[model samples]
Each structure stands twice: as structure tokens, then as C-alpha cells.
Target: MTTLPTQLQHDLQALAGEGGYRDATERDVTEMRGRYRGGSTLVLRPKTTEIAAAIVSRCAEAQLPIIPIGGATGLVAGHIASENQTGVLLSTERLVNIREINSTDRQLVAEAGVILANVQAAATAKDLLFPLSLAAEGSCTIGGNLSTNAGGVQVLRYGNTRDLVLGVEAIMPNGEILNGLSPLRKNNTGYDIKNLLIGAEGTLGLITAASLKLYPSIKDSCTALCPVASPAAALALLSQLQHELGEFISAFELISGQGLHFLREHFPQLPQAISPPPEWSVVLELGSSAENELKKLAESALTKAIQKDLILDAVISQSETQRQQIWSLREHIPLANKKVGAIVSFDISLPLSKLALFIKTAVPKVQDFDGNLRINCFGHVGDGNLHFNVFPPIDKLACNYRSQQTEIRSAVYDLVQKMGGSFSAEHGVGRDKVSELLQYGDPTKLEVMASIKKALDPNGIFNPGAVIDPRK
Candidate 1:
């Protein structure tokens, strides 16, 4: 199954030529979650979109699957192809280019392979901001971010990756280039194909380049880590802060006591904002164009919340160093989770009104399912997205609890469904979540999606097992 007919590899190599062909590396064949392993296949790194289109065209003629491997930083198993699947792994890493930065128009264009942090740096160079951010920004590429329509810390204010994209230029299933990277905000001439590809997770097409929207750089900001008695108390404080700070509130994260414990156990020397971490706390950040204005507003809001008995203790950042220290606690929680290991992790979102209720009901239920399990509940609370991960007791290993993963997921996901929440939030439904998507996904919507897949990929040559399986 790993064989690509020898001649096909040679043909692909000739098509890619010289610098385009690269030997398979350990990282390329493995996914982030350790769920899927890629098969031995030709890895083609096209330097230009034309070469990419030609490669796709060649694959289409032979009715071969094409997997567009973006940054390999995807949480879900989207990029990895199994042994039975035969095709070329097309990489856009060599397609790194900051095509244009229109300062006057407040937009930038970049190829798919550029790392997200590099794009942010380019925008910063122009005195602008690209608000899409995630923990893996340093490694994840812009194409991967757009493919998943990733939501990060600033989603509470700037919206998800799709909202930040003006347009995208992609290669359709037939290897034809769809030039939709328009700088204009308003264009209603045809079908909204740009959107279809944005969150399609590369099932419909391979996104090559994008025109992105940018925001004005913030000159000042205020950050604070305050303890809340419970999720409900955090919700109350969130409302009060929104009323006081309005759109300036950039990020609002909920941190759990166990997360702090994990950090202390692993990274004891790391600077922490709250010592002997409270049972529940929230990190709130506000950004503005004005100089030294948001701090007083944040202070006034925190004071009112404390008086109202919503906040237990407030520690506002005094300097830029202090601000980073406070954020360090929030940013490193996932790394800590990785070290401690999780039995099962859920990336879910609920209605703002149901956030508190869902957490209150879920904690006991999950713990009751496995008495020894510990929960780490936190995420971008302002946007209603939560990364609720379950871990084993200090002495227990996650592998030992593998038998209960199904039950644990059912316990949490069923409740999420009842609350009208999503089982998959920021992370797109990759190979890992296909079953859940079918179980929880709407039937009518699924049918339409299947039809779309069939229409675009008539030969079923574009990512055979991704997003939607080949329609009958």
C-alpha cells in the first residue's frame, strides 16, 4: 500500500523538479495527536502556485488523491494520509511570500506556507495588526489557520480567521486555479466559493494564497488576573467588564486550579501572577489605541466586581513584564496538559448564558464517571469556547484509562448537544472527529455537504477520507 508505482514517484519528482522534491521527514508522516500515521509517499514542495496547479492537474488525470500538507501543526489529523491512500503529499512550505502589504488600504496578501507569526511580524512592520492568533503561531502556517478557520485568544474581539480574510486563491479539485483574492470588501458577482474553502479543511480545494484584513496597532493595553469564586462569578464579571470596557476587551480566559498545579509540578521556576493559585480565576486583557487609558478603566471595573462579591482577589499588571507574566500562566496551560497527559479533551462552545450552567453540571458528571480523574476547564470564555480536558490522578497514566474514553466523551458531548453547543469549536472536524460529526451533525446539512463534495470532486481525487467521506 505504501508503493506509489515507482514511475509515479519519478514522474512527480520530475514535475516538482530540483528544489521542490524533499525526502519525507519524521514530522511530515506524524500528526500532532499521535492518532494517524502518514504512508510513504512523494513530498512535493512547489515554489509557485503554477507548479502546484500543474501537480494537482497531473494527479487528477490519474485519479489519485492529493493531500495538501500545511504546517503539520494541526490539532486534528487532517494532514496525515494512511498507507492505503495513494497520492502525493503537496506541501506549500516553499510558497512563502508576503505578496503585498497595502498600508493605505489596511490589507496584506501572503502565500499559504508563511508562518502565522511571520505574517504578524510583517503586519507589525507596517504598523498594523493581524488578529488571528493561537499557541502554535510560531509554527503553524497561514494556510493551516485558514483551513481550520482557527479561533484564538483575540476571537472575543476580532473574530475568527475567516472574518479576517478578504479572499483566498485556491486550486480546485480539477487543478484549476480559482482566483478569488480580492481586496474589496464588497463583491456580489457569484457564488461565495471563497467561504466554502476557508473552513472546508482542504476537502474542497487546496488553498494557495490569501488576501488578509488588518487592524490598527494598539498603543496601550491593560491585563489582569483575578480570582473568581466560580464559573458563574466569572461570567458576572465578564458582563460588568464588557459594559465598562466595551470593544476594547480583547481576551477573557478562564483558568482552573488544576492547571496551575500542573504548571507548578512541571515548571516551578516560571513566573506566576497568582501564587498558590485560586480554585478559579480569569485573565482579562483590554487593548486600545489611546495611551495609558485602559488601565484606569480596567481598575474601576475590577473594583466594582470585587464589591459585588463576584471577584475574590484581583492582581492587575503593573508593567509590560508583569503583563507577559500574567499571560504566561494562560498560554502555557496546554503545554502543561500535554506533559500531564489527558484521558480525553473536548474543544466545545456553549451559549454565553449557558456557560456557567454547563460547567456546573459537567464537572460532577465527568468526575463521577471516573472518580480518580481530574478536570482542567479553561479557554476563551468571552467567546464561549472552552477546552475542557480530563486528566488522571498524579500517579495514574492516561493510557491506563483508555477504556473509559468513549464513556467520558459521551458524558460531556451529550450535555454539550443538549445545551445547543458544539462538540467541535475552534478545531475543525478532522479524521478524529468524523464519527462525532455524523452523530451530532444535522442530516440536511450533511446531505448538502456531501452533494457539494461530489460536485467539486467528481472523480473523488481530492482528499478521499477528509471532512466528508466519498459520497456513494
Candidate 2:
């Protein structure tokens, strides 16, 4: 483990003041998923961007490493320090301030430390909507969302966090601030620097604040739980809904029976929208200018879908309580997955046309590798992303398949690549997927990423062993 130089520690303390730096706690240096363990001598919680910059500047001068963290809720081990790595964990929790809100422009400027749920609530208070949402919204910070370019259920409508953000203020590895926090909808002056840093995880810089785009408050929203015979039918239903409802289709999720079964086995208290849930089901959510109109269009669309044999049965939510309960079922699957334990988990995206075939072909391939494997496939089907996870046989434990992890992942990812899909979809390539990125990423694109990392962070202190590994 690299130990902080005594002199450098003293310097950092002086720069950040006594309250700024403290010994790293488990909370400061661990990942939410428990997939990785991180170690660091100190954790720095800077109250302001200026102080953050000062800390970065000193770290750069001293050739010390830094890990930029926010909320520490990321599934990938992006913010976790290495096993023996010594560095300062820079937390943005204190920077939790919504700087500005412009209802007229349908935008808001918020600091990186702002909780995503708070941002939603702030926009709601203004009678507007910031639609970048996920299960982690209550704890994940806007900065982490921007860092990973997080895509949630609403990607089918509002796009990812990158789409919701108009501008950002970041501190480069060298402590130089890039003030790109403009709320303009269109600025085609030059290269898109803000985007380059975004989704770069923290290798490029530390995002301090962002100017986010907001939408008009949702007027009429409708939710439905539709049971389909197969994934192909679900895709067809999605097309029909798009053709009929257009942009009103905010979320279209594909769920497998295994996910619901997991919930039933583990989280039985959670209500199931469907009593006798089908093997394959979908959660459809639509929002429009008029609730009554949206409900009519949705009902009409479902009727047509049912008549065409595209859907077997469906439950359209009649009230807010019903809608929330439907959503709760969708969101709780991941928690149940955790309790059940997974042999291997994958976040993959495919061409919409290839999604069904991929699932059909990949499931058997995984079973071929180990006949006892159970697959739980689910995610935002509207955007072609799926959280395809593998579990051991019902009587076995996850540890039973631990030795075959590489084979299991390869079976799924190889199929994903052959079908022209991404091995890593919305989940950014943190340390967990670095090898996969190197193996599957485009050669030229990887070369350019390395060049950008070198040019922007010559010291390689931003986030070592992250998206682009310097060791390579």
C-alpha cells in the first residue's frame, strides 16, 4: 500500500483545513455492490469547488493519486481505490447545493454533490421535471450520474443523464477548472469538451457542477403491466405502442418470470401487479399533455395489441397507488437479485432486432456451460438494454458456480458481440470492465481514449486502473 508522505499529508490538511481531511472510513472507500474493496489513507470532503481544486492541485504537484467519489452508490467499482492504493477520497457530499433554477428556460444549475432525488424534488417544486431517474436516485449524486452518463428507465423518452445535462463545471486532474456550465440548448462553437469528460468516469476530471435540462411537468401519466408470450411479442407491442402513442411512451421494461420469482422467494412483502404472472411480462409507462387522452390512447393501443395476440393479458393502473405499486415491483427486482445471489451479472445492449434472438441463443449457451444455471433477463427494452443475470441451480449456492465465472461471462458477452451488441451498456467501464473494454472496444476508439487520457491527465492521478488502464 502506498502511504501518504508525511509532508504531503500536512500540506493537504493545511490546504483543506482541519475538518476537510480525515481518515478513510469503510463508507468512503467501498463500492455499493460489495464487488470490490478499496483502501485509502485519507478522505477529503471539500465544502467548495475552490477547495477541491486546491486539493487536486496539491495532489498533482506531489504525484499523488486521487479518487473522485459522490454518494458512493455506484455498482461498478469506479470510485473504489485499489487494494493497497493510497490516495484521498474526494467526496462531494458537502457541495449539495442547487445553484439556480430557471422555470422559464426549463433548466436548473446544480452542484455535483446534489442528490438526484433532491434535484427531482427541486424541479417538481418549480413545477418542472428533471427526468433522469433510477432506483439509486435517493442516494446517488448528480455528479456520479453525469460521470457514468447514467441511463435509467426514462432513457426511452428523455435519454440518459448526458442528454439531460446541458453543461458542466469540472476540475481537471491538473487542478484547472473547465467552466462549461452554460444552460444554452445549442452551442455549436467547437468540440464538445463537456461530453468528452462525461462518461469518462473520473479519469478525465472531477465534475463539480452541471446545468441540467428540465421538461414540462408530466400532465397525464399511465402505467400498465402487460404479459406477453415471448420477447418478440413484447418488441412488437413496443413498436405498436410507439406507432400509436409516439413520444408519450416514457418507459417500456422487459421482465422475465425468474426476476419476479426471485422477488417472491426473497421479498414476498412486495405486491405483485399480476396474480398469476406470465413467464415474460412488460411494464409500460406513458406520459402526455392530457391524462384522459393518454389513458384513452393507451387503452386503445392495448386493445389492438390484445386483438392481434401480441399480449395475453394486462393490468392498466387506475390510480396513483396502483401505478406506484407497479413501479415498486419493477424496481425491487434488483434488490431481490442481490438477496438471491448471482453467479454472474451482465448489463448488455443489443440492436432492438437482435434482442430476442440474443436472449434465446444466450440462455441455452449459458445452460450448456452449466446445465444448472438459471437466467434472469430484464431491463429497459425500449432502449435495447438488458440486465441479463445468471444464477446457480435452485438447490445450489452462487459459490458453486464461482469457478466458472469467466466461462459464464464469456458465453453471454461473446453472444452479445456476435449479435453486434455492446458488452457494457449503460453501466460505464469502471475497473470491473476494463479487460472487457480492452477486448471488445474498437481499436481506434481505444487508441483515441488513451491519447485523451494522456493529454488531459499526464500524471494519471484522476482514477488509476479505471476505464483506460495505464498499466497497459
Query: RMSD of candidate 2 to the true fold?
Result: 1.1
After TM-score superposition, the amount by which residue 407's alpha carbon in candidate 2 deviates from its true location, in angstroms, is 0.9
Instruction: Give model 1's TM-score versus the native structure.
Output: 0.98
Q: How many clashes in each structure?
A: 0, 0
Cα lDDT tens digits, model 2, 1-472, are: 5878899988888888757877877877777656688887688888889999999999999878888998888777999889787788888878899999998778899999999999999999988999998988989999999999999999999998889989999999999888999979999999999999789888888999999998988999999999999999999999988898899999999989999999899988988888776799999999975555777788899999999999998899999999999999899888888888888889999999999999889888999977878899999999999999999899998988778999888878888999999988898888899999988999999989888888999989998988896685
Residues 1-472, candidate 1, lDDT per residue (tens digit)?
3567777677777888789988778788887766578884578999988888888888888787888888898877888776787777888999899999998878999999999999999999988999888888999999999999999999999999999999999999999999988889898887999899988887888999999998999899999999999999998898988887899999999999999998898888788777788999999999986685888888888888989999988999999999988888888899889888888989999999999999999999998977778999999999999999999977999999889999999999999999999999999887778888888999999999989988998887766777785534
Model 2 residue 403 distance off true place after TM-score fit, in angstroms: 1.3
Q: Report, for every candidate in turn, its global Cα lDDT versus the true structure.
A: 0.88, 0.89
TM-score of each: 0.98, 0.98
Best by lDDT: 2
